[model samples]
Every structure is written in C-alpha cells, then in structure tokens.
Target: MASTAASASPPPAGWASDPGVSAPLRHVRAIIADHLTHGPTDPTLAQRRAWRDALYDAIALPPDVVSTPVRDGAVRGLWQSSPGARHDHVLLYIHGGGYEIGSVRSWRVISAVLARRMGVRAFSVDYPLAPEAHFPAPVDNVVAAYRWLLAQGIGAHDIVFAGDSSGGGLTAAALLQLRMLGLPEPAGALLISPWLDLTNSGKSIDDPPGYDPFNPRAGLESFAHDYLAGHPATDPLASPLFGDLHGLPPLLIQVGGDEALLDDSVRFARRAGSEQVAVTMQVWPHMFHEFQAWAPDLPAASAAMDDAATFLDRALADAR
Candidate 1:
C-alpha cells in the first residue's frame, strides 16, 4: 500500500536521486539487469539456494552490530542490535524469498540497519524454507517466534512485526492468525513491497505501468505454487489481500512504482484503509523491489528506511 493521504512524503530529488548517491548506487537498475544475465537461473532447489545465498551474503553489514543466535520451539533466528537499540523493545523481522530461501544470515545487514534506525532489538527469523516446509509452516513459525518474545516478558505493545515481499504477507497473515486465536496483536507492522496477493489478482502485475528489471510475474507465480504445495492460493491466509483487514495493528507499507507488485501494496492499503486500520503507505517512483536493501548507499533506499523508522517510532509511542 502507498501513501494514502497528504501526510506521506514524495520520492527523492534529481532523477529522483538524492545528492551524494554514487554512480554505483544510481546504476542499480543496470546492475540488476547485468547480474541477472550473468547469474544462474537454475530452478533446481540446490542451485537456486546457492544463487540466493551468494547474492545476499555479499551484502555488507556495518561492523558494530551484534547478532546472537536464539530459538523458540521449532523457530530459529538471530537477535540483532546496534548501539542505538533499546534492550526492552523487540522487532520480529521476517525475510523475503517466497517462503523458500531466505535466512537470518541473508538478512543481517537490513536487520542491523533497522535495529539502529528504530532503536530496538530486532529478531530476524530463519523460518524453515518451502518445498520442504510449505504454507502454515512458515506462518506458524512466525507465531511461535512471537510467543517466544511474549514468554521473554516482552509485552505485545512493546513489539512490532515487519518483513519484505513474501515475509510481508507472512506478517499480515500471522497478525490475522493471532487475532483469530485470541492472541494479542503487536504494536504495529511494517511491510516492504509485500506480496500480499498470491492469486496474481493485482492488475498492475499484468499491465505494469513502469519497468521492473527483476521479478517476472510467472517466476513469482511459480514461487507461490511451490509455497502453496497444492493448497488453495485464494485462501485468505495464503493471499492476505482477500482476507478481512479489520482489527489488525497499525501498518506502514512502502513500495516502488516500477515493481510488478505495485498493485499488491495498493490494494492492501485500500482494504486496510477501508477497514479503519491506521495505515501510512508510501509509493516511491521508479524504484525497484526491496530497494531498501541497499540503504545508506542508495538515496531512495535510505529515504524509505527513514520513513519506516519514523512510522515505527510514532506507532510505538502511541502504543506506550
């Protein structure tokens, strides 16, 4: 969902590029194109995992953050924090990879960045991947992780949930699941380019208005299939866009105009807004998927992170 009201800010400056952003940062679209051409496209599980791991492993994390291993029943994750962190506040971060490949190690840099930016101790889940552990498994693991946080004495009001892409869908679904089972929801949620519609029901996905260098529609559809593993894609829990949006926590969603998943965010924002949920949606022009992954280097990414940090700060304050 994009900025639904006048309160939301617009995109960055020049080429919509912030000043001081290097040529490498500005050349991101080209870089992605080049990488895809040279990168392996093997759909084989082993090959796919290797490619993803290599790509994410190359992301450089700042040296000062600490990431400690932790577990909650079947869930495994990393507790990430920086000097700016509050030991009492917790963020449950779910990583994207269509519920298949991502892990806490792969998302360390982003987790660390959020920890510093939001001044909270963040936990990144290493939920079991798909083809091996499909629907319900990943979502359930997220629930388990949240319960673990509760058991640690972190109140629901002190914790926030967040994720990107499929993980974003998981965050929304998990919140819905919690509410269904009489569990308290978190303070709020932050979704980055969330893949909320598994049915590819979003119009923009088929008739995209801008160029998206990555994330082909068919490829994403395939990932959905793998994760569903014969389950119904239209199930509200699987494709949260079709689900009831009422009574969920505050939501802050950021999405790129150029991405195919644009409508997924847009529709979710509209639904949430209709449901009277507090939602601040920011639509960044001409940006790519999960652009925030390159934050502090790319102006757009940094700006998006700042937006998220501000939203979370306000939401947490309101919760308190």
Candidate 2:
C-alpha cells in the first residue's frame, strides 16, 4: 500500500551537511544565491519574464523529447512527449513563478524531463500571470485545460496533476474546485516545493534553518499582493495551505529540506493527513527551492525526478 504518512520533521536538522550536495550543485546554488542577492530588487514584469526564462531554459531537455505549442480555449501551453510515450496517460503541469512569472517554454526543463522519464505526454500550461490576470484567473485556466484533456478522451484516473512553487499552490486550489464541481478526481498530484501559504505566515519564511536563495519576505509579500488583487489572502483558492483539504486526491509533496518554504510542505502534509488524505511529503536534504529544475547536473534533482516518475507510474497503474 502507498504510504499516507507525511515526511520531514520541523527545523530540518543539519541539512547542509549532506554529502549528496556535489560541487556542481553548490556552484549552481551559489550562482542563484548571488543573483537573488544582487539582482534587481524590483524588476518590471517584462524583465522578470526575460530573466526567469533565460535562467530556467538554460537547463536543457532530453533530446528525445518533442515539444509543440498548444492553444485551445483558455488552455495555452506546450505539449512535450518522448518516443513511445503512453497516449492514454497525461501529466497536467503548471509552471511556477509565484503566479507572476514563468512560462511553458521556461518550464520545459522540468515538465519535459518528467515526460521523458515517465514515458508519457506532459502538458505544461502557460497560465495568465499576476498583474495580468489576478485571483481566480490562473485557477480557472488550469481547470479549463483539465476539462480539455478529458474532452480528448483521457480518463480522470489516467491523469496526474503536478506543479512547482505557486503552480503547486494553484494545483491544490484547482483540485478543490474540481471537488466542488463534483467532477471525478484525478489519480494523484505532485507538489514541488509548493508555496501554499500566500500570507507568508509560515515560520520557515521568517526563520529558515538552511540557506534559500529565493525571494525575501517583502518580495513574497509583493507577489502575494499582486496575485490576490484585493482578494483575501486566507481565501482557500488563493492559499490552499489555509483551505480545507478533505476529499482531495492523494498527494506527493516534494520539497527541498533547505528551502525556506519547507514548512509550507510540512504543514500542508500535516493538515492533509489529519483530514485522512494520503500524503507523502519528502524533504530533500541540502536542496533549495525547486531544485528539481537543475537536473542532470544535480544528482539530487535527478533523484527527485526518479522518485516522481515512480510515483506517477504507480498512481496511474493503481488507477487502472
């Protein structure tokens, strides 16, 4: 049976000492840390998009994976698939940039790799960003893409939802919305370093035991403000960490043990488990926020993707 227990205890004791953090991984971490420290404190939306894409897209995708642009209804994204991938199974991916930045092209480094690894097609949605479309817009876009998938004859049991950072939060909100609509639930979900708490109320935000090169508290506050657009931060759809998780599908939350948002996954797993949801939360020691994006070079990143592929395969097989 699948483990429902949440992983990783609080305070993340001595995560920086993990031997798995190789020299290349440390160099990558340093580069990102320097960029976060010295880069523009307040960047325009265009500049943010350019910088994020340039940085993330630098991580190349597997050569065998093919990518194609997709535009249908409210669903705008990239479809990535490897040779011999299953046509019956699909991975609905949401790219993360705090709901402000990130695009389908930028996230191919992640979703595409998972597609190749799982031998399945992955649809990475390019949802409307904050300041462009706030509140429920991104959530609605995800729901519409899901509906489009079903229209293509894919069963709910053959699909698995996955997202990183804010996209992860959006995935959670979308699941809640699906439940509310009385729609069939997908097989399961993978939340990658999910930023589920928009209020920045988690203790890890203020005091993290390990180094996290992501945005500071004020930056997160600004992003949340833009996305919320006067909506209450505590609103379930806006912040799933603050929402009722009952009846949601099984969840596998993979978070970096060293990321400041570690508590977001830890606390979310705790609450979901308390509500009888099957939750598997893995805290990767010495990894930073969304470290899975640095795969091939980072051993831990490849390992994380390996774990994700295993989970996705098992979930879909069990559903069958």
Candidate 3:
C-alpha cells in the first residue's frame, strides 16, 4: 500500500555509521566540509558547471558502453546503451542541475552505467537551462524528447523516465503535462532526491545541515530565482508537489534522509497516493542530495542503481 500519511516515517537504517560509505565519499565529504568552512561562497555559473562536471566525470563508466549525440529538430540529447541492452526497453534520463547547470555530458557516466546495468537504451535530454530559458521550456523539451522516442518506434510501454533533483522535478512536471496532452503514460518513473517543491519550504531545509554540505538554502534559492525569473514559484509545472498526480504511472522515489528536499519527495509520495497513483518512496539514511551520481564508487549509490534497475525492468516487463 502506498503511504498517504502527511509525514513519512524514516526507514530503518544506521544512518550515522553506515559502513557502505566509501573511502572516496568520506574523503569527498571532508573536502566539502573544508570547502564550506573556507571556500568561495558565490561562484559564477560557468565555474560551477565546470566543477560539477569534473566531479561527476571522476567516476568512470564501464568501458564497453557507447554514447552518441541525438538531434531531432531542436530536441538534442545523448543516447547510451551497452551491447546487452534490450532494444525494446528505453530509459529517458533527466539530469539534475536545479534547472540551471546540468548537461547530458555532466551526467554521462551514471546514465551510461544505468543503461548497461539495466540492459536498456538510455536517452539523457539536454534541456534548456535557466537564466537562458525559464519554466515550461525544459518541460517542453522533455515532452518533445518523449515524442521523439515514440518516433523512434519505441512504444510508450517500453519507456521509463529517470531523473535526479531538478531533473526529477521535471519528470514529475512532464507527467502532468503528458496527462493534460492525453499522451500515454510511460512504464514508470524513477526520482532520485527529487526537488519537487520550488517554495524551498521543507523542514529539512532549516534543520541543521547533516552530512550534506553542498546544498545551502541560499544556493537553492539562487537556482529557483534564475529558473523562475520573476515567475510565481507555486506554479504547478514549476513545483509538481502542488500538481495533481492522478493517472501517472508508478513512481520509484529515492531521497537521501539528510538532504533538505527529503520532504519534497515525502510530500509528493503522500499526495500521489491520495490521488491513487502507485508510489514507492524509499529513503536512504545519512545520504546526501543526488548521491546516485557517484555510482560504482559509492556502494550505496550502486545499491540504489540495483533497486532502480529492478523497478524499471519489472515495470517495463509488466506494462499492459
């Protein structure tokens, strides 16, 4: 049964002393703590992009996966698949950058691993960013990408949408858009540490920061401001937590317990269930935002991928 409770109970786990925390992650955490204590507060968007990409690229992809650029009119994205991928199954991956910073290149390796491990073709869209494009632009891009996938002869039942952070927000937004457009639902969706509430109004946001040192409330506000650019933050498309989630396909929502956006996912799960949507909200103890990006490096990340692969595979297989 899906949880319709206003507040979700935190899952049982030894958050503080998780042995799965990798040496690399610990080292990275220390570095972030040090940076928080002594690094520059405001960095140019370009600088942030470069730094984020470098950090993401540090985790290598399996050697055999192939990646290629895809351009269908103004819809540009990256397509990834390994030798063993099931051609009939596809994953439309949305990269998280708080609607501003991420790119297909920045998220290449993790999506590549997702493709290889799940044995499905993966497409990561290069949606328009904020300060350049505002709300509904990226939403439109994702809708177009879905149509493009359909044009590729892939059935809606074979597709799964996966995203993290703002990309996860977009996934939820796109589902609502699809319903309004009368398009068929995909097999399912996977949301990793989704940022569903644009209002930045979550209990975790104010709770003293735990293991997460990167996501300052001020930094999130910056992304929201750039993305909204004077638009109301409560717009349904801007914040899916406020949107009606009826008739959407099954959703697997994974959020780290220590992050500010934990309530976004929890509340979303609650609301979706109220609307009778199938929702599985999984909370990882002591994890930070978008931690799955460190896949194959962090044991927790890899374990999350396994759960994702299982969910996507089953959903695609069971599609009516």
Q: What's model 1's lDDT at 106?
A: 77
Extract clashing residue pairs from model 1: 1-265, 2-281, 3-281, 3-282
Comparison by lDDT, 1 against 3, better one: 3
Model 1 vs. true fold: TM: 0.90
Model 3 weakest lDDT span, ten residues long = 1-10
Q: Which stretches of candidate 2 lie over 4 Å from their true place?
A: 1-21, 34-42
lDDT of 1: 0.79
Residue range 182-297, candidate 3, lDDT tens digits: 99989999998888998989878778235454456776787888889898999989999999888999999998878878888888999999999989988886677777877765
User: Per-residue lDDT tens digits of candidate 2, residues 114-200?
Assistant: 878999999998889988899999998999999999999999999999999999999999999999888898999999999899988
Candidate 1's residue-wise lDDT over 114-158, tens digit each?
768998999998888877888988888899999888998999999
Model 1 worst lDDT window (10 residues): 1-10
Q: Highest lDDT among the candidates is held by which one?
A: 2
Steric clash pairs (candidate 3): none
Q: What is the C-alpha RMSD of each candidate to the true structure, in Å?
A: 6.7, 6.7, 6.7
> Over all chains combined, what TM-score does candidate 2 have?
0.91
Give me the overall lDDT of model 3: 0.80
Error of 1 at 229 (Å): 1.4
